[model samples]
Target: MIAHSVEDPLYYLHNFRQVLQWVEQRYADLLDDQELAFLQAFVALEQSAQALMVRMVMRKGELFRSDRLDYAEIGDTVRALQPLQALGWVREPEQLSLDQLFALLRKDELAHGFAGQLSRPRAAKSDLFAQLQGLALAPRPLAQWFEQAPVGILQWCLQPLCDRMRLLFFGNLYQDWSDFVLADLGVLRFEQVPFSPGSRALQQRSEVDLAMALHHCTERLEQGEAPAAILDALAQWRSDNPWLARRHGRLLFALGRHCERLGDWDLALTVYGRSNHAQARIRQVRVLERCERWAQAHELAVQLAAAPANALEVQALQRMLPRLARKLGGPAQPRRRTTAPQLIELELPRELAELGVEEAVRQHLAQAGAEVHYVENTLLNSLFGLLCWDAIFAPVPGAFFHPFQAAPQDLHDADFQLRRAALFDACLGRLDDGTHRQAILDCFATKHGLQSPFVFWSMLDQALLEQALACLPPAHLKQCFLRLLQDIRNNRAGMPDLIQFWPEQGSYRMIEVKGPGDRLQDNQLRWLEFCAEHHLPVAVCHVRWGGPA
Candidate 1:
């Protein structure tokens, strides 16, 4: 755990220093000359200066008004900034674009600066900016733009370098310095996995660069950049790192979806062809079929159907192959029928609508012997998380890089289970010996509230855990857990909404509740089918509101 003194004024600075030290220790070899120089120079700075620099970096945007940076601890903000400016880490830009000028100045300041030019001085700030859009204004310094402007904008020059250091420390861009503060404040807690010397996410500097490039491409795609251009940019790079490669494939998949949405079928097909994402092939088939390329679609669909990737692909192919066969004027492929789960039909009073369909059903089912709880995905997932705590948080080389991770870095990877097979086997082995119940209970008691990809601490309680452990058979749990491990990302969800436990009988039934006009989603149907196939007791409950009439 990260030690932080909240009462200390320099707590944030302490956290920032810790990150730099961590990155320098683990990723020293991967650090470039600039990063190395920054690290060396940063520690030499006065505490006040370092605190102000972290304050600026942690704040949003590159441009910041000096007046807004008034920190009580860092007395004389301008004095603290001088060292940073001298190091070229912070700079006062000589020229600012119209947008920058507009961003920094108030509406009154803008009106004051361009007193004669504005026709509507009383308009909103956005309207005032629109009023200036027509002018062919060139970039100029703050003084040149507005002589009476109270503060100058300072740009954090080394944000990229700092971001690289941050990336090294956390292994991702989404988590920033605030995570440290959050952890310190007890808003977040993480498992303290023992990280070995070899444990780190990126092995090389090139991987770091590749990850950043992929992140940039994703950002551009999100910002409405042309998919073809982004795809062209993406074509220039390839990564040997499985994690980075997965990121590349996911980006390609996204771009393909973007193209399909834009009606660029050829471009979508081209993007999908370049991608190795699990669903990319199916997407290509769908796009081809949409374009009326029946022969090509059928050819790919036939190939996919012969050896489907997973149950999801098989499900899609079952529906798609027959449709493609019809389109290509071939004999209709026999549709594989699945045995649906047992159904329960109910008509409750209209006033029960406030409790929701699942809750209403739970109330109806709850009696002297049976008790129902809305478990959904939480119960099973939490059980899996508790039992497999040792395996999931194993100190594998690349599995765990940082202390803040909720799960292993490769949690969603294809080789997630394969990499930690022995550890998972050991965890699952306890089930056969009737030891899993105790192991799960022990883990639940000890590791509660720690961050986990599976455990929902808020949704689980001791009573629920007791009931589930008592009523749910070990064999049934093993089956569900195995299926969950088969496709962790997709199979983690779509569980039945409510679980009715008969503790005395040592039995339980999962209920998938559906209100009027509600239908089972593909994932839900897949779960239901899996439950039926494994002979686990599950039912689909269709509910309707019945009034006094």
Candidate 2:
């Protein structure tokens, strides 16, 4: 059953209440006094008052003009807001800056209110604001700014508190109240995994605060804050929580990139050195090379090459080591190269170009005895998702914290596979006993349409599933799945665009299509190399627009 329907006028209120109740029940100990009081006072509010507060919380920005808010379900907006205002949850803004005032006022209102200041009354709002910049207006209340203001601005003061509750419930700030509405409306769906009592995302109050701090730091970085300042702020934080630590690492990595763009090599080196992100070390090497520190670059590149983190790192080192060696006046290192995949050259009618290269290729390949489909990254990932549904959705502590998650929280963590090694082994064991086909089919039938981290329900139907099972060898599937588990964050993508099955012969070939002038991406190259090493039937299909010569 759905959580809440949009047909209900109080759907948003219901969703908000659900979050509050969830947080209150699961994270009571972690809640501050203010948060606990909010829960208590919110329940005591009248239905309209609660609804009004939720409407404001869901909307963008803190300030809302009273006249702009009109809800039919809540009889009077002002009346509904009174209880909230009395509780200090909503208040008239004590002051607003000129920019804030400009944001709140309409162009007509600005023109009408400051007639003498605006030399060109018909000028754009931005130009009007620019002309008034010389006045050097100080921030003041709406009343003090204008003699007769059309509407009073009300600010939602408790947004941060509400946001804390949301963070606790959703595990991240990216997914907001709209997620609940989307789930309710059936626009999005998630698997309902049972949660243990200790399955919450942030276990301690400190962790919650740290997550919020990292979020704010990210915002400041995006707003063009100096990298040095953000780095200083980050250096003060330390977290044992791996999830939060990963977030911290990502922020550092982003700051490092920003520094690189600004040509701040020293800062970028420091930032990259501090990050544990997968690509950070490679970036550090590149930065060293760029700054002409060939010895240091070569030393680090050699260390990384000795124990590369993943395929991407290996791919990068192949290019870096040779260049670094040349710069350091050392012997030229023999670069490792993979044999290119078998090639198919096509020249199709220009009229067929509109169908897209992959589609055109699929059409050309499809025949009386062959079946072709544009599967891309979906088919293999979906197969793996279906075959290992239990392992992926296991009820491990801190994994399935909420019912709305499509996959476990640590699906991309370094230890994701290790934590569920036994479970995955059991799941993959079906291959040996010749039960994997049935297991995959059963999952496809039973768990169809449920959200998953890997499965693409919209793409994988019964026909494709059967054909893949019939043609692709279990050994081949196992190899690909193992590679996926090696580094899911990077390896989940870059699969061939199309696959053709000769069901009669129990054989299939994966095809990576390249239109004229389009070349293989790095990830695609990695996948092609992997397939070649495994002796998997794969090819690169190159296409030109004109008719065959």
Clashes of each: 0, 0
In terms of TM-score, the best-performing candidate is 2
Candidate 1 residue pairs in clash (backbone atoms < 3 Å):
none
Q: What would the TM-scores of all predictions be?
A: 0.91, 0.93
Mind giving the per-residue lDDT tens digits that candidate 1 earns over 1-549?
A: 464767777888887888888788888899899989999899999988899999988998889988899999899998999999999888988888989888888877787788777899888989888888888788988778776766678899888888888777776777788877654454567888986566666888898998899888988999999998998899889677777777788889999999999999999999999987878989999999999999999999989888887778888888998998888788987998889789999999999999888888898888545889988899999999999999998887667666677878778776788878999999999989999999999999999999999999999999999989999999999999998898898999999999998888989999999999999999999999999899999999999999964
Taken over the whole model, the C-alpha lDDT of each candidate is 0.87, 0.89
Question: Which parts of model 2 have CA positions greater than 4 angstroms off?
Answer: 111-124, 183-188, 331-334, 349-351, 545-549
| Candidate 1 lDDT score at position 48 | 82
Model 2: per-residue lDDT, tens digit, 26-99?
A: 89999999999999999999999999999999999999988888999888988898899899889999998899
Sliding window of 10 residues with minimal summed lDDT for model 1:
180-189
Q: Give candidate 2's TM-score.
A: 0.93
